[model samples]
Target: MLSIFLTIPLTMHSQSLFEYQWKNRLIVIFTETSNSREFQKQMQILNQNQNQAGLNDRKIKVIHVIPDKHQIVFPEKSGWQNSNLYQKKESKIDFEVILIGLDGGVKLRETNPVEIEKLFDLIDSMPMRKAEMRRNDN
Candidate 1:
């Protein structure tokens, strides 16, 4: 009788699991709310689609910025209600999606994820994305 011991490599798999490669790409931040399960499910689906589309190198980071008491101010105070992106949209009590460029500057700020495709288009049109595509084409 022969006994064999097999060791599973956990580090590599774990790294890939939590490692999103969007450090220099577009940042998609979502405010966490009581109805966060839906957003989480949507994000999971989006990640799956991205992987299937061969966009592994173009990772999208989904950040959940939980608002504190002081941070929870009325939207009307900051002209948020009048913004084009927020005018007619109705969101849950606490929810937001902020799109930021690679330089850490906010590009498109919205109160819903319905316009996420626009953010993708904006990122794809960025100079970095163009350069990366050119490099890959070589």
Candidate 2:
């Protein structure tokens, strides 16, 4: 159930993340640019097909939010989207990572590049995800 709902003009300046609420868990990387070192490393860590698979298994989408450039990048989308939607809401930090759950709750927040294993472990521990896995296993 890869939700590839590729709508254009990703610059919606509203408080609601309603579009991603029920369907996808989200990893939001807040950085100054696509080239930011921490951002690069974080993106690189998840660049593998297996890592991507892990994310898909958990119904997760990685989004790069570059407030300085007024852009947010969606994994399912082709290019960077011009938007200030995620700017300043989390903070003015140069780099930060946020893990959002399917229910639109902030599951984890970190000032450094996230460890994928840690992220996966947290998700796997969640009751919702445990049920999801049980259904899949059955």
Candidate 3:
């Protein structure tokens, strides 16, 4: 939820992923298409109303990566962003999910559809998340 509306200049779009580093944790979903089964399931899991509070609390921003189009769909934004992070050749799989931490590192990788709570649990177990919880408890 941190700086969710902040806009970055186009010149730095290549480093847009790092633009979120330290400010928010990321759940990047790389899928073949926005309408794929895995993509739909993932979106369904994310759109649940009950998960809103937790999602905001954890500062999670979801990015949908359409490898075929070589673009990333950032939340609260309108069109696709061309990202070099995704290359169809680089990933042979059709559906892949990656959890990135505040330090700009990949924390988890899942090939199939995963539940939201599972992701939340994984994030909650992170050392940085522990520290963040401690800080918020004050």
Candidate 4:
């Protein structure tokens, strides 16, 4: 069952789960157990490419926060990952990856070992993403 879920691919699952309403600017991320250093490095690369693309820099903004359960949330897995960052009282957050939209909506969520190109494609294809960019330039 786990393998089935894993095989579904983050983008496809997220799109369906989000109902394609995810299009046109939002946050997308691939999180994993923090102990996975390779995942972190991959995330770094994704961010770098995104930065160069000027995607988040223009209209939309993408962010990745590493949640520290002990420091941020006492119980840790108690919905902290799903909780709205603003709603949480803790000053710190722990997440393998987080994608938030300009409107503060979550686009997609997943664990690491993802296809980075798919993420980039998703960003490029957002209908509103480009519009937001144009609006920002003005």
Candidate 5:
């Protein structure tokens, strides 16, 4: 596994998805608008499990993207834009949750709100996470 402290910050803009690519595992919430019920439910699950056993110690970051609103909300702040990060050809019209790994790859994608336990299990099963655990034990 790559050393956590060695990751680089990619960039800053109306959307900063790449900024977290190598530094933290990202749970990106993409919605048509911030008012979606599914988005709310997913956010609630993340909030509830953020500090729980399987997730707390891991470097996880959350990014909320609302294409209709042209906004991106990070944990500490949010940004608004006239244009969206999702282009017309690549955008998903429905609500979606995307889990990006520290290696800058999409690890998981779901159309429905996910349970925290399930998310944790998926994350814990990753090879990088397994190596992290081994390193910590030593």
Candidate 6:
């Protein structure tokens, strides 16, 4: 399994979003508005399983973006921004969730809330995750 804790950069920038999450899986959540019900549901599921997802060891980083409102919420803080970066990655739908692998590529996208188990299972199946697991076994 992937390691439990990894060092993230001290700074965050829209231009280098993926660069900061270079070796970590990213869970990007986009909503039409900050108060959207779907967004709340997604947050709840993720928050509840924060420690349980990703091979029982990996801790996913979550980025909540309300593009319509030009706001972004990080796990440790929140701020206002143009939303161009997130908007470009979002689907046409108003509410969407994207899972990006450690390789900095989007692995999954959903228009509705996704169960934690489903997300964990997907991560556990990744080749990189398998390699991490094997390495940990020894």
Displacement of the residue 26 alpha carbon in candidate 1, Å = 4.5
> What is the TM-score (0 to 1) of candidate 4?
0.41
Residues 30-89, model 3: lDDT tens digits:
777768898888877887888767878899888787753433343454467566455622
lDDT of 1 by residue, 13-125 (tens): 32121132235333333454524765565455555544425333554444443432112121111211211222221345456555444444455556655344666677678
lDDT tens per residue, model 2, 1-138 = 122122212322232345777688878787876689998888877776778889889988777777634333445754665556555544567888877787766777788988789999999998889999999998
Q: Please write out the lDDT profile of model 6 over residues 1-99, one tens digit for every residue.
A: 222122222113344454645566777777777788998888777666454444236546677776533433434445665546444643578888877
Residue 11, model 4: Cα distance from true site in angstroms = 21
Question: What is the C-alpha lDDT profile of model 5 across 36-83, one tens digit per residue?
Answer: 899888867777644444454677777676653454443444566554
What is each predicted model's overall lDDT from 0 to 1?
0.42, 0.70, 0.70, 0.39, 0.64, 0.64
Q: Which structure is stronger by lDDT: 1 or 6?
A: 6
TM-score: the better of candidates 5 and 6: 6
Model 1 per-residue lDDT at 74: 15
lDDT of 4 at 54: 56
lDDT of 4 by residue, 1-138 (tens): 122123324322332223323342434332334344755565465456545455434333333223322111111122334323222212223333434343334445554434556656665565666775578789
Model 2 C-alpha lDDT versus the unseen true structure: 0.70
Scored by lDDT, model 5 comes in at: 0.64
lDDT of model 1 at position 124: 76
